[model samples]
Target: MVTGQAVQLDSRSAWQRMRHWAFAHAVDDFYQGLVPASIPFFVLERDYSYVAASGLALAATLGSSLPQPILGVIADRWRMLWLAPAGLAVAGIGAGLAGLAPSYPLVWLLLLLSGIGIAAFHPAAGRDARRAAGDSATAMSLFAAGGSVGFFLAPAVATPALVSLGVGATALFIPPAVLMGFVLWRFQQRQSRNPVAAKHSGGRDRWVPFLVLTAVAVVRSVISGGIATFLALYWINHLGASQALGGAALTVFFVGGVAGTLTGGRLADRLGVLRTIQIGSVAAIPALVALRATPDPWLGLLAAAAVGVAMNIPFAVLVKLGQDYLPNRPGTAAGVTLGLAVSAGGAFVPILGILADHSGPQAVLTALCFVPLAAVALGLLLADPSAE
Candidate 1:
């Protein structure tokens, strides 16, 4: 007698969704953790110059990023449920192998391998979760925060491993990668009969908003890339801080991002994504500029935390905006927002590196401040949600 479909949210279903978010976060933590661990260490130990060393980061970014639009297109055409497990396995293996590579060329090849594998997971996982979340900003924020948590945890886990296990700790991360694949497969099978995914096969393009959003994303990433590569070095050189304190600042930066990711999403749910981005962009300017002026390590650290929060909160909300815009093509939007914008950070690391060498890190950072101002300018033109 019952012929139609049913859409209901139960406690069990909610728990499953949360688990998926954590799993996805773990995957990113593993992917991004490699940069702090392998990239710098590779350069220092090998005696490579900044420009040449940057090629490792560049390879990872170029490998991961340049493929997203194409990957999103493929996601639109085919649902590769199997890729979830396969991609994680490959990424894990590639990361582990990087430790063992006989030379720098092998490191690049391994990172590229890892990049391809990590690249496969984001778009698919994002699309699947958007269905479970039902286009809510809080849901997307929680999802994004999970990655921040993983990013924080990854270095904490790996750095100690470096002291005890030497480079082999890299390979040891493979078990978790394999576990991620299994979890995704289980979640997909359970949710297969759920009817809420109907929007996925329909239409999901908000051309104007997407273009505007991507613009801010690019500018934000340029600043973030500059920070990630040079923040620690600047602190050590100018602030008279030890290497440990500088590394701690990096932790503070990412921790603020974790806080921002969750808050940004929740605030967007209430205040709206456009509003959250405006506030975050306006708020970040002082934090970023202050780093150049402040000599006090404590003040700089506080500003760094503020910078992380102001800069990254938009990342979570922006992904949700992409989903809302392209309701049918959630995976594609997710890929472009999360994969491409985040990886764009890699492209600019070298540019800033060059500028820092010629003009000094302070000058490079000061010059980069205009990028956020641009984000603020372009963000004004973003269409209200009602348009979708």
Candidate 2:
């Protein structure tokens, strides 16, 4: 009876920690989602060219991607609990300033700063999330699903604000970041005082397999980043849809991503991580092809949702699998899987934007159709790290 009670209490505690981390994850990623959602407005309001807009994305990508592995190393060596909360504050301030900046250079810098905050947040937060959730894929999924939920809400939140209040409305988004940051700061301080050692499934890092996984993840990222960057433009420019409808399309995709992330975690537990990734990779190709081929805007929206599910079905599984591949360097694994590999796709969006400049958004999206095939091939090369 006592053992049962203790187990129940631990479960409850674990859930509470997961909820806190998930909420922080949502708030941090909200800024990330905001970047893509806001790009259309930049084009419309500032008369920015597609290449210039993609440069903005590149700035964010560079800031987020370059320093993440270093930050992960720092987190591992120092156990920097404060980084999670501090990063939220920095991200919010940077995003808020981005809209208010007068020059393109200033705007680029602000977004870059925001990206750095995002980079800082993920490694430490993900490491803690793993600790909080232990080995439960479902619990880890719940935490990861928060980012998808944030991405889903970004259009819902930003579209209305941008439409009504203009870019300056980003200032209004800062309070929640401040509030969440403060709460998390206190939470981390308390946790540090009573730090619980994380259990490890001792193993050597498998660099070869991990590199293959990173490659697959990078391909997945390109598909995802390309879709987010161009989906609204496709709807508005190609389909002659309203701005609101374009936002709706992006929201639909993110909603499907939420569903996929949650389902992937459960499937990883039932099947295996490698199998789940392979299945998602295989499924994505058809969905993206259908999305590219559809003429009707409404059909395209449904296809977008399908693409989201197919692409994101391996989201949480990748993070878990990377950790398994490098149990000793879990922070480095999380940094690469969650940050560098994921953001690498965004770094290439400018080339896609160059394509969009000449070939139209459809052409750019059509190119994405073949990316998942590459990911599928890479997925086949990855053996289940746990099996070894």
Candidate 3:
């Protein structure tokens, strides 16, 4: 009975800690979302061309994506808990200041700084969140969903402010960063007083499987990026939907991602992570094919939602499994899976863009329909770390 009570208390404590981490993850990624959301306003207010606007985006992406693995290695070497809050503060400050900058170069620099901050936050947060999550895929899912929620909230939160106040409205988002940074810092202080020892799975690092998993993740990322980039266009052009309905379809797709993240975690806990990923990979093909086939705009919304859910079901699990696959280097695993793999997907988006140019937005969706097959193929090569 005493042991049972102790287990309950531990579980409750883990749940609470995961909640804080999830909230912090949301706050960190919110700034990332703010960049793309704010870009159109920059073009409008500053008379920037498409090329210039894309450069700003490239600056952010390069800054955020490139240093992550190195930072992950550093975090692993030093066990730096401070990076989480510090990075959060930096991300917020840089993004907030971008709107207030007078020149385009300054704006570009500020966003680059913001991206670096985001890069700094993920590996450390992933490492610590894994500690908090223990073996619960559901808890990890909550953390992953927080990021999705942050991203989903960005346009909603930023659009109103940008519309009313112009680009300078980005300054308004700065306070949340300061507030959340302090909250995360205080949480860290409390955690230090009662530190949870990192768990060692006593397993050897399996680079081949980890590489396979990374390939699967990159495939997932490509599909996700492709859909996000083209779904609204597909709805508006191919399906003959109103602009409003096109936006709604995108919203439904994102909301579905949040749901799928949570669902994947729960399913992982029951069905195992590897199996859940396989299911999601298989499921994405059919869902995307349905989206491609649907003629009715309203029905296509349903298909979009289904595609979102299916594509994202492996989202959190991939992160968790990456760590499991590299038990000796959790930070590196998270860095690559969370950072590099995601950014790598963007590199391929241009190919889809070319296809969209030649064929149509619908052709992009048609191409995405077959992309998940690569993930399925790679997934078959993965062995559950737990099984070993």
Candidate 4:
């Protein structure tokens, strides 16, 4: 009876910690979503060319992507709990300053700085989330869903702010980050005072499966990033929808992602991670095709939602699978699967942009249809790490 009570207490504690971590994840990633959300405004307000706008994206990408592995290594070596709060503060401040910058270069620099904060936050937070969530895919899914929710909320928040008050309204966005940072700071302090060690199942790292998983992640990222980059344009240009409707399309897509992330966790818990990923990958191909093939704007919206659900169903599972594959270096696994591998897709966006420039948005989207088939093939190669 005492052991049962202790187990119940531990379960409750784990959920509380996971909730806090999930909130932090949402706050940190909200800044990332801000960049893409703000792009149209930048073009309209500043008359920036596509290449120039993409340059700003490149700055954010490089800042966010390049140093994550190194930071993950550092987190593993030193256990930098403070990075989580510090990262939120820096991300907020940088983004606030970016909105106020007088010149484009300064905007790029500020966004880059904001991206750095975002990069710093992830590995440490992911490591701690794993510690808190243990082997429960459902618990970890909550953390992943938080990020999707933040991304979904970005346009909803930024559109109103930009429309009413212009770019300076970004200042208003800072307070949440500051408040959340303080909350996380207090939580981390408590954690440091009464550290709970995470149990590890001793195992050798499976590089082959990890590499296959990375490939699958890269494909998923490409499809997701491409859709994010082009979806609004497709709605406005191809479907002849209003700009507001274009924004709505993006929001619907992200909402679907949030649903899919949460669903993936439950499915993984029941079906195992590998099978869940395979199902998602296979489903995504047909969904993407359907999205691209639909001519009616309203139908396309539904198709886009379907595509989002199908693509994101594997997201949380991939993160957990990576950690399971490399139990010895979960931080490194998190860094690669969560950070670097995900960012690699952004590199392909420029190519898609070039394709869009020459052919059209529809053509680029059509090309994206083939990516999920590749993901399906890769998914088939991945065995459940737990099984190993």
TM-scores of the candidates in the order shown: 0.89, 0.95, 0.86, 0.93
lDDT of 2: 0.85
lDDT of 1 by residue, 298-348 (tens): 788888888889888787888877766776566778788878877787798
Q: Which is superior by lDDT, 3 or 4?
A: 4
> Candidate 2 on 1-388: residue-level lDDT in tens?
0000000114455457589888998898888888888888888889989888898888888888999889878766667778889888888888877888888999999999998998998888877777777777777788888888888888888998888878777777888888999999999998878866544556677989999999999999999999999999999998888888898889899989998998898999899898999999999989999888888888788998998898989999998888778777767777888888989989889999999999888888989988888998899999777676
Per-candidate Cα lDDT values, in order, are 0.71, 0.85, 0.80, 0.81
Clashing pairs in 2: none
Candidate 1 segments whose C-alpha is farther than 4 A from its true place: 1-16, 163-168, 193-204, 359-363
Residues 1-388, candidate 4, lDDT per residue (tens digit)?
A: 0000000124465457589988898888888777777766676688876566667766777777888889877767777778879988888888877878889999999988988888888878877777777888888898888888888788777867876777767777888888999999999999889876544565777989999999999999888878877787787778888767777788888888899999999999999999999999998988889988988887788888898899889999998888888777767777788777777787787788778777767987899989888998988899767576
Off by over 4 Å in 2: 1-9, 196-198
**Model 3, 236-335: lDDT tens per residue?**
7788886556656766777788888899999999999999999999999999999999999998878988987998899999999998888777777878
Ranking by lDDT: 2, 4, 3, 1
Give candidates' CA RMSD values in order: 3.7, 3.9, 4.5, 3.8
Instruction: Report model 2's TM-score to 2 decimal places.
Output: 0.95
Global lDDT for candidate 1?
Answer: 0.71
- Give the Cα RMSD of candidate 3: 4.5
